[model samples]
Target: MSTAPPRRAPLFRRVAAALAVLTLPVAGLVAVAGPAEAAASATATYTKVSDWGTGFEGKWTVKNTGTTTLNSWAVEWDYPAGTAVTSAWDATVTSSGTHWTGKNVGWNGTLAPGATISFGFNGTGSGAPSGCKVNGGSCDGGTTPTDNPPSAPGTPTASGVTDTSLTLNWAAATDDKGIKNYDVFRGGAKIATVTGTSYADSGLTKGTTYSYTVVARDTIDQTGPASGALSVTTTGGTNPTDNPPSAPGTPTGSGITETAITVSWAAATDDKGVKNYDLYRGGAKIATVTGTSYTDTGLTKATPYQYHVVARDTADQTGAASAQATLTTAGVTDPPPGGAVKLGYFTNWGVYGRNYHVKNLVTSGSAAKITHINYAFGNVQGGACTIGDAYADYDKAYTADQSVDGVADTWDQPLRGNFNQLRKLKKQYPNIKILWSFGGWTWSGGFGQAAANPTAFANSCYNLVEDPRWADVFDGIDLDWEYPNACGLSCDTSGAASFKNLMQAVRAKFGANNLVTAAISADGSNGGKLDLADYAGAAPYTDFYNVMTYDFFGAWDAKGPTAPHSPLTSYSGIPIAGFNSEAAITKLKGKGIPGSKLNLGIGFYGRGWTGVTQATPGGTATGPAAGTYEQGIEDYKVLKNTCPSTGTIAGTAYAKCGSNWWSYDTPATIASKMTWTKQQGLRGAFFWEFSGDTTNGELANAIHTGLQ
Candidate 1:
């Protein structure tokens, strides 16, 4: 697979652009104000918006009531000794010692007789300021503003009542100045201020009656009277003698595959509602979920597994485990005549600085496990396929130790590089087929030209792959077109059917017996790459499609709220809704492509960010993290020891150590994903270049064992 910058959602792109222009100061300054010099002519009011542990946001409204039209105005306040303003919006602020002055900006410098202007600021203190002044005059009481308070909010209704939690919803409040927020009160104490009409209250005492009220506040700090009170009684609390939920009905298993089983049970009755169910495998707890069904994956082929379910209620009480159900997974079935295709890419450049040669595959045991190898990547030049690097492909000399068969290359040899080593490996493993892949991310720029005259392009590729010098080294060809009608490293404007036409020409030239495959985009977002081309029309001409499913998110975005690179499911705070492995598979299946013709793609490396302070996935980062080959990326072999996984989320593992945070898949997560692949009925899974894995090929072992 080729690497590209991370793509952003359309809505998030606009937000990110806006944030780039909203820079503010990090340190606060202090300024002192002169003593009051004139009689009070205007009034100013201050309101606190929100307050975190170390910072606070505040707003101020300055109103003119006197008949005189003021040409300019400024507001001053005295802060505590250690407090200071950090940033101000819609106004220019300066400070001296404990005194702060806020001057009007260009747009709101002049004030009419009855006009008011509002400005806000972020500060580094908890306490509100005092000794306020406007235009160097006392602002306490000379003029009364004409703004009216909003009307009281309507009564609230409560539902989903539990022993310790309930939800409250109310009608929206209306105001001339626009309602900004509503303050929720419980037992005469302010509980929360929110912009929405509904709120969930949790952690309440059981069997207790609670009184609630709400008050509407407008943008100018005008608050209306509180609404009428309403009371709700919670359900009774748990008792020492309370009985547990009944044993779940006998569990049943279905959708059994070589490595997975789906188990479900009938709902169990309880004094309180059932909170969740625990699933056990071989007498060990494997998973806990709120639903009645769960898929147990990553098991051995033809292995017998025992499963049981136990239901629990809101009181943390679990019932007796149901009778165990046993199932033996079926063995993998081979294709009728041509065997399942377990293909992986072998980059020509891996023989350079990476120091990975064809010999590594033999030593690491990956060659015996895979069925086919793709030599990537040849390039497309002048509307024809050509060699990307002549030296790497056929001219570089390898020593006896570097060669696959322990034979040194002679300077006069016609073929001497990776092309020759691959030929030697194929001789040892006769079943392993090799295909020459062309048009990677960087070289795909010429595809638009090739699509213009596909017959000529196919002729060029056919003659090159079947050249007499290396005719015995290759079986067929594979097209790694980054995209056809959508954007990748560059943009393509050919019609939607251009890709299908090109694939047809290649199949016609290569014949049916020789394998012809293509790697296509798996973007499932609405109007994404999948919709830009006619993939279904091209599927019939190719043996199978490699669905590139990983790299959904990464640090190519520089500053980001970090997220997993390849999430299998949608979590609570996922950045994009449709950018997951499941969504892509469902989309292709919906597009009339059979599940058995698709092969899932996985990344052998991990992506991450730097300058992260929080351990969770959503924390803000400064930029891309440091790496050996590139920033924001590292091999799984290095990350497995550098930043070990601390927890799992969204079907992936994440780790946070000191100021660095990273996310990657572990052996256990890969096992779970393999189960999902079998459930989806996909042909198999493939990864990128082989050099990223450990010397022992730990990740390769996991993929081989999980697929079995």
Candidate 2:
């Protein structure tokens, strides 16, 4: 293995080059698929144009790829039992039961070399087309997968038990096409359809025991085998809501000491004067006081505690509980468990030319595989956080066919666009946590201003992410400060503590429940980006870090020797020292950051150039290779078929053809890297964006499988 030429500049302008617009939401889900793939001669590819609640629009592109003319092309596929083509346009579409066929129009049949034509049809039912054939050949220019249901979900775990409510969580199942949602059953009776890994079952009888199991359904609504049962017994007591005075306000703490603190809160308003306020440390009642304050003693020093209050009226009814307040005694708290965090970024702007959407997560089966989504990006400017794109965030209208819930957005709705759809997505996949990511390659220029007033920046972000209109859409916030005390799209000279201080401020505002994370740099050279900031010091304030381990090399250099942008290790003739993912992890770990707190980053696209003279790395080239979405950068979906892997180097795949070369991670390479990720005891793996994978999310699925 060998490296390529030196960097023109040690900067990765990925988003800036990939997207020129200044638009994205505070948070949203996004994904993409190639318009068409290759075939033996004339090829056809399918894409779901728009999905209304009741039906959707489907399109197919037929292209002549055999260096000859194609006179008339026919595409055929099978829809599930209830799904059918309702109408056709620019083509004659006909169906025999569930088997459908479409032929090019009389005037549009002929396609010369590199030429193409498209036809679309209105469809009912939610099933995607399968077994696609272009002019009697496989549509993928390879093997068409056999249709099969997903495997059974893992056995569930019961937690958060209460008299009337309890939560059930389980691992997700796997499928080739992708899992859509999970169906939970109680005592063999179907109870719920949820898109996430957990379910909170409520409205139950006290002292009752129930058996729960989960079954997964694929994108086509095919139910798989059910998980083993998990029996949960509700606590034996009156429902918390049945008893009450009004709920108390958030409790405040003062006179904090190593061993104790004075906790006070606003009193609950009750028609019957409040009899008492019951204070709790964690979930247990610690004290019953008639007044609004209590001095809790006997706490360990340098430990963290959570407190809440409930009110009881003269009739002894238990009022609702106040919001939980978290406090650390004497010192900062340690980071939590190092569980795996499989995260991905969802760009709000991808819905435009990419035509990706939140519903695509369900349709493409990605939502089932990912544990979290970092919606990129909100903006950081004027020393505070701000909306990246208002229209995309909460103002745009969506038709029922294009909406996540299959319900049309009303003009008078308080919120629409991605925010509304995200809220609906959470309702279906409650287990998939979302973070409002602020700043990226382009927007990060404002971090210098934000670093000057970290507290103000933190507060602004809190207010926006928690805004009532779409508050339910996000679980927390993610800082994508490209660099601190270093150069990125811009430069920052804030002291080393600036990064830690900003993270501390955000943690203070977001509290313990909500995730507070950041996309940190992975530069590992001496005195590089990692050395310029106090990431290790900030670990205490972060749930985990999404280490940006990609972009070590790319067409950013314009001309010269090609190399894998995201190399796993160093090799001969390397352009720079300590510029690989392994070096970054080693450096961070040496600095005392736990491996569990780090997630390895994977790129969903490739960066390359043309005019290459050799088939291997280190070959000189003229400039960047042509790309569909952006020059020098191409989505993996497109490259997988067009440039197919010609070789492997430094734990990644690369291709070379007729002076053209590109580097990207295939499902095979991704699986291998995931293996390395686990061996390193790292948290998990993540990718740049979702829309770069196949419609069925093969790359995302590979990550899911590798982690398992």
Candidate 3:
């Protein structure tokens, strides 16, 4: 999945540890010089926010307690052996082995007397740093910064009343220092401290009177005055004779993808207000929602699914099930005159240690869901396309269990390995097309040479792909040239028009019905990889462009402020702007590529980090996380059970457990992405490779279901 060179330690250290001080005079103010000792004096406070086994997050605050204004400052600390700072914010951080130094950024360098600045970092290994010093002075037993308490919060109001919950909102309080958080109290007992003016109190008893109040607090832990209390009685109560809501009206299903379906029904009546509706599929309860509609996801393609709904009351009473609604989802249907396309990639090397043979596709049920699979990766050399591995592609023999047709390969057979197995798979699932992909990140070095003789290169590819020995195994050719005139594993100076020229040559030789396609860079940054080629001109010669929308960030940035590899939307504080699915789709369409000719990319695996101290994203890490195949990367099958998603950000799933943090898409997130794809008018979706999925193809199922 990563096209970049194998990761190593970063060459440049952005942070360094030193106990030096540099002072500069303030521009529009008269000098008030102080003694050297007094000017160098400062206070530092360290706080541990979270600790998860091998990693922890810590915050450091420095206050200028000297009489004269301090022009600049630096903080140094000795990290425990085996520990390292992976990321830092609000300061320039650098590390030398176990020692870390943080210097004030330009904006926070100058501090007047009594002024404080705070910065945080993520680190690896257990325990806290020791021997901390601020501006060459001991940080231990330093003076604590002081601040005044905030003003009293305003009276609270309750709304959206329910038997078990109510919403509370109050006016914000003021503070000389910033209001850090607000504490909410129920019946004289503190419940929570929130940063906003509102809180939702849930799990209450019906018909019970409850009183609520709020108090404000400043960053220095100063609690302010409490707001006037307000009391409210819940609207409903448990009653033996209370009637449950009637069964929901006959449910109707629509918007069917290969793996998901949206069902909606009319609301039912209830003596007590209806609390929620329960949805069932295949005689099993799937979900309960407060809305009239629900999308049942993670389904198998081409399968018949029956669904119904029932209503419930505040008393936890349920009604009868409504009439069943049945629907057969779209499967590996042939591409219609003009419709969505679902494509996936199959790697030849997976047959080895991963034990993912071609038969696994059929056994895992992925073959029936996918309309096309690209066989990766044939090599590029001598300015021509060629088979990457003769044994893996067509020479190695397959056992009966490993073969798609349950037949053993003969020693003297003309074709044996993955190619023959693919031929059999196509026979079984006739609608599933196959393409031979050449020149991935590792093998893209030859594209520059290939561009020099497009016609000759296309001729070579045609001969190999259309070879009489295994001609029917492939339906077309997919160019995975990494980049045209930009840098990947290697740089190319083939010029901006090179890619369009190459695609035009291939299309002219291969013809239109043969399905010419390419996987192109989705870097949405201005003047990025998309600007390095003439993709718009090449679009006319290709069936579609597979937009690699994932891998925007990862542990590849070893000293990382970790982020999701594939984020759907741009969230606040995203490391890079426009490096998201929305931005890619918009930019591609803006570049004159039709939405229907673009396919979104989803990663079947996840990118992660180790020695992660924070439970949420934006935390720093010591280095790449440990994985079975490669550090910093793991298959979804392992993470879904070992880590499990705890929360979501930017439309992707992330988890934190012990010292590791991982981000990948869950079934629910995939469904949402599929909806977005349709809304954007994109053709469909595809994942990197098939072998990373579960034995039953859980992530693959999610992709199929969400696309519908």
Q: What is the TM-score of each candidate against the true structure?
A: 0.55, 0.54, 0.55
The C-alpha stretches of model 2 lying farther than 4 A from their native spots are 1-338
Worst 10 residues of 2 by lDDT: 16-25
- lDDT per residue (tens digit) for residues 560-598 in model 3: 677888899998878888788877776665555666778
Cα RMSD to the true fold for all candidates: 19.6, 26.6, 20.9
Q: Write the per-residue lDDT of candidate 1 for residues 1-708, one digit (tens) a residue.
A: 111111111111101000001111111112223353322246676755444335555667676665555556788878877777765555677789999998875546565567776666656654446667677664344222333456778888899999999999888788765888888989866788899888899999887789998887776655665777889988985575777898897788889887778989998888778899998764457899999999887764544566789999888888988887766567853331344456778888676556788999999898888878889888898999998667778988999998889999999998988899999999999998899989876577799999999999999999999998898999999898877877654567787999999999999999987788888887877557777788878988988888877778776455567888777877888887777787777667545565677887767777788889988888888766766554566788899999999888878888887777788887788788777777666777777757778888777777777777
Candidate 3 has its poorest 10 consecutive residues by lDDT at 11-20
Q: In angstroms, how far off is 578's CA in candidate 3?
A: 1.4
Q: What is the lDDT of residue 278 in candidate 3?
A: 91
